[model samples]
Structure formats: C-alpha cells, structure tokens
Target: KFPGVPRVERVSFNKGPLELVRHTHMASLGDAAHFEVDYVDMPAGFNDPDLSLEGGISGLTHALEAQGARVLTKEKVVRGSCEGRDTTLFLPHPPRKEGFVEGRAFGSGQRYYFLMFVGEEDGPQLREMARTFMESFAVTDGCTAQPAPTPAPSSPTVVSVVEGTHDAATGWRKIENTELGFGVLMPGAARHESEQAQVEPFPITHHTYINEDDAGVYAAEVFGEYPPNFHNTPGSYETMLDVTLYAMKRNFEPSGFTITPLRDLKAGTFPGREFTVTNEKLGAQGRTQIYVTAKYIYVFTAFTRGQAAASAANALERFFSSVRITTK
Candidate 1:
C-alpha cells in the first residue's frame, strides 16, 4: 500500500519563507502545498463560477461510472489499505482548466482520471508545469507516460526617452533624446559640414547647422573669433551680433537684402549681438535674427515672406525683442 504523507504541518526556514510538510510512516515527504489556494471570490461582471464547476466535474464522474468504476470520498483519514484489485490514484486538482475528464483504455486496460477545481493562491505560477504532468497520465496500463510539456521563456518590454520645450502659446514637447542638448534641434533647410564648404567670398569660415520652417529659419555657426583665442572671445554681446548677421547674409544673399529699424521700443535690449527684420527671399520676407555673446559665435537666422513675414516675425520676434544681458 502506497500510503501518503502521514502528518501535514506548516514549517519555516531560517534563510527564507515558510513551507508545509507531510510525514509518512516509512519515509515522510515534504508537502507540495505552496500553490494551494485556501479561498477565492468571483467579482461582479464575471461568469457564474458554481455552474461551471458543476458541469465539468459531472461529466468526469459520468465517464468513470460507465467504465464500472466506483466513486469514493473519504470523510476522515484512514490507515493504509490495498484490498481492491483495480487501483485508484488520488491527485491534487488541476490548477488551470475549468473542466475535467476520465477515460478508459480497453486495449491497455488502464483507467485515466483527473479532477478540476478553482485555483488557490499561487495558481498561475503552478498551472503550466502541473497541467503537463497531469495530462501525461493518459490511461497507460503497464507503459510509462511521455515527458511533460515545457514552457517557452519570456522577455521584458522597453521604453523610449525624449526632451522638449514649454511656453504660454505652445505647450511642452520633446525635441529628441540626444547627447548634444537643445542647440542641436535648431532647424536646417540645407546644411554644410564645415566653414570651407560654405559659399565662397565670405572671409570668416565656420561649421554650421541650419533649420527652417514657415515660423522661421535658424542657422548656427561654430567659428574662430577676433581675439585669436577662440574660446575666450566667444559669448560676448557685440561679437555675437556680427557673427549672427554674417551667417544671415550668407543664407539670404542669393536673393537680396534690406533692414528696417522699428521706432517702437520693445521691452528688451539687444546684447553685443542684435536681431532685426531684413528683406530676404524665403517664407514670409522678414528675417528673424540671433546673436552670440562669446569668444566663439553661434547664430540662429529665421526669415518670413510677404504677409507671412509678419507672422514669422511675431513667432520669432522673441529672438530680438526678448534679447537682454545681465551684469551678474
């Protein structure tokens, strides 16, 4: 007689969590009770749980009854006994499937059976391995069952990162995730790698990046400066204005150029660099300008066309209108 674990009790480990154990007469074995579910409740807006369980178990009992099998339920535990010629094996309920079944294999003369019940705690983690092991017990007479099914592994999900700007008119948006920072986002309609590649007759050489849209055009220059010590001279007000205007003329010269100074005083002061609206051929016809106040120069030039120039100027008016300097 293959009597099961004699005594069942919960135990704790010094290194980790607690576990349950089952002791037997000959050699006691550990309890595989970690996945046992003590209780469960069906939430609203779900199918009827009771009816489903009844249907599945009823079908299983019917199948076994047809094969002249007797059903027995032990009220309380009994001492070991092996009197019956046909053996019956008691198994834990299948964790996942909502149905159960029993089958008789006449050729092999073996009876296959299984039980289905609502899952307990840790149901999900135990279901995959448990289901495969139970399914392999297919009505084998003297033959050994096939191996259990193995589950495929899974991987983690990934996320992307971006940066942006915020103001009263337009909200926040991320330009891009980059190593260079905000200046890299300056628009470019056409861009040249180094000052040497720029249009000829322009004495100052620079590495430039440019951007353009109806709002405005932006041209940035990284160049050598007057002091000969490039870094020291950069970030100064006047020097920055010169480099910015130079880059603007270079960009718009293919057409023509003119500048109109506004008598209306805007709230801010133009630093060493200045921004102005110039007659330039492109979207809208007014120019949006920028100045760099440093040993080296960086410029952003934007222009608008015809009536559109006014709108472009307004959009970028902040460039010159908002320019200011601090003593600190």
Candidate 2:
C-alpha cells in the first residue's frame, strides 16, 4: 500500500476474463522485509462470495503471522475488496525477487512479485528494456505456490594486468651514465624520479629522457588518480613527433623539402626511405642517413668536405640502404 502505486491486482483473483481493478487499499508499514504469502484458491468467476476474498486475505495474513514476521508495529495499510476472491493485493509494496530469491513463504502457498523501479540514472542504457519487462507483468489469480523465475545470467569479459619490469642493460648506452643516460637502442633504464619541471599542471607519473639537458622533457601526466575513462589523449610517440617537427621548421630554410617513396621490406629486413636537399647559404653540404624503424626516425648527418656535395648525396642513398632495423 505504498502511497505511490494505487493498487495490487493479483491475477489469481481474476475470473475467466482478464480484468484489472485498481483499489484504494493502501498502507504504510515498517521495513517491507516483514511480510509473507499464503495460498487460498477460490472457485472461478465473480460469483464467489465476499468471504472468499476475506478468506484468501486471512489465509495470507495467517501464513505471514505463522512465519513470525507479524511484528505488531504501529504500521497500517488500507484494505478492501473488488470482485473479492481470497487475496491480499493492496498492501505494502510486496517483498521482491531480490529479497526472496533464496525461497519464500506465505502459508500453504508462496507468492512471487515485489515492486521496484530501476531508474534511468541507475544505468541509462537498459532503461527501456527493463520497463518493457515491468509493463508485461500479469498478476496471478488462483493461489498456487510456484518457484521464482530463473535470473538472466550475466556475461562479463574481464581483463587482468600483470605487473613487472624489464632490465635496461641490453641497449646501446649513450649520454652520461648518471641514471640520466639515454639508450640509443630500446631498453629502458630502471625507474627513477624525474627532476625536470612538469610541462603541464597535471602531475607527471611517467616520462622518458632523450636529452637530460633539455629538461624540456617528455612528460606523461594526468589530473586524476585513475587512468582516464576515455583514450582521447595523445601519448609519447605523437607528442615527441610534434615537438621534433616544430623545432626543425620554426625558422625558414632554403632547400625546401623532398620525401622519398617508402620501400616495404620482407620479414627480418628493415623498411625505410632516402632523400636529399642542399642549403645554398651555409655552403654546408651534408649527407643525411634516413632510417625509419619501429622506435624512431633516425636521420644522421655527415658533412661533405670541399665540393663533394653531389657525391655525398649519392653516399646518403647507400647509407640508408645499408642500415638495418632489427628486433633481435
């Protein structure tokens, strides 16, 4: 007999025809946990006597009392009859499935069905589906204790993260070995604290050092304590690319630009490109070795002595062709 819902129509009270009547039978009680179901099957049709309805209700009340839930609290609910057949429909929102899944009792029979509203805020996506099931519910009439419906099995996929670390001794060592060392190859140094100022206001939890002097370093930080719910942020690879490209082109250059075609390599082989351009002003003719590998864009510069600029360009081509990118 919750104030919100006007009635409780047990389908068992209906005769041959499907009729739903909303009664004003209402009440407010203590915790709904203190309730029970009792069975009372009346003869078919609206011709059943008023006592049949009262008997059905009395039987349920008796069953409830027998179950020891009848704590005589001051709780009160409205009660009455429609085309009476034994039933205690209009009452406190009945104890529901979640509360009764283990099994329940009312008297010689058990009653199923409790009221609940899973609001949209609880989980917005499945609201319509849940409402569809709620609207289709039919009240039971002739009392017969029945087993509760089987619950829908949940299917959830779980991923586990295994924590560990890798040693750094395998890579080519470059720079001062003060833990500030840069491994030209891929092995990462042991984890240590970074001394540079974080580029952004967010606290930095992870970072990498290519040049310690540049303290203008690669910093990975986040505002919150948890990983972001969405991956809209860029990582080290993209950030480094942007910073490097910006530094190279901040000032105008004379030779313009030229990009060679990419050559695909077979397994165990390295894929890369080669290109050449000259700066007329610096007279600084240089040969550039271009090796595009998994971890980096290695562009090594070798200056041409005297007027060997054109020859150095050809040498640059061979250098790129000979260089290897290996994962072994």
Best by lDDT: 1
Per-candidate alpha-carbon RMSD to the true structure: 32.3, 29.5
Candidate with top TM-score is 1
Q: Model 2 — TM-score against the truth? A: 0.22
For all candidates in order, the CA lDDT equals 0.33, 0.29
Q: Residues 1-328, candidate 1: write the lDDT tens digits.
A: 1124333333322211112132212211133321111111222211322222232233334444454444443121111220111112133335633222222111111111222321222344444434433233323234232222222223322222223343334332213212221142332223434433222112234555444555555544455332332222112343334334544565555566654432322113334333455653443444443433233344444555454535555645544343232211
- Which runs of model 2 end up more than 4 angstroms from their true locations? 1-243, 251-274, 287-294
In candidate 2 the C-alpha lDDT for residue 64 amounts to: 41
Candidate 1 lands at a TM-score of 0.30
Across 149-224, the per-residue lDDT of candidate 2 in tens digits comes to 2322343322222112332443322221222111222112222233322222122222222311111111111111
lDDT comparing candidate 1 with the true structure: 0.33
Off by over 4 Å in 1: 1-207, 214-216, 224-251, 260-271, 280-283, 288-292, 306-310, 318-328
The TM-scores of all predictions, comma-separated, are 0.30, 0.22
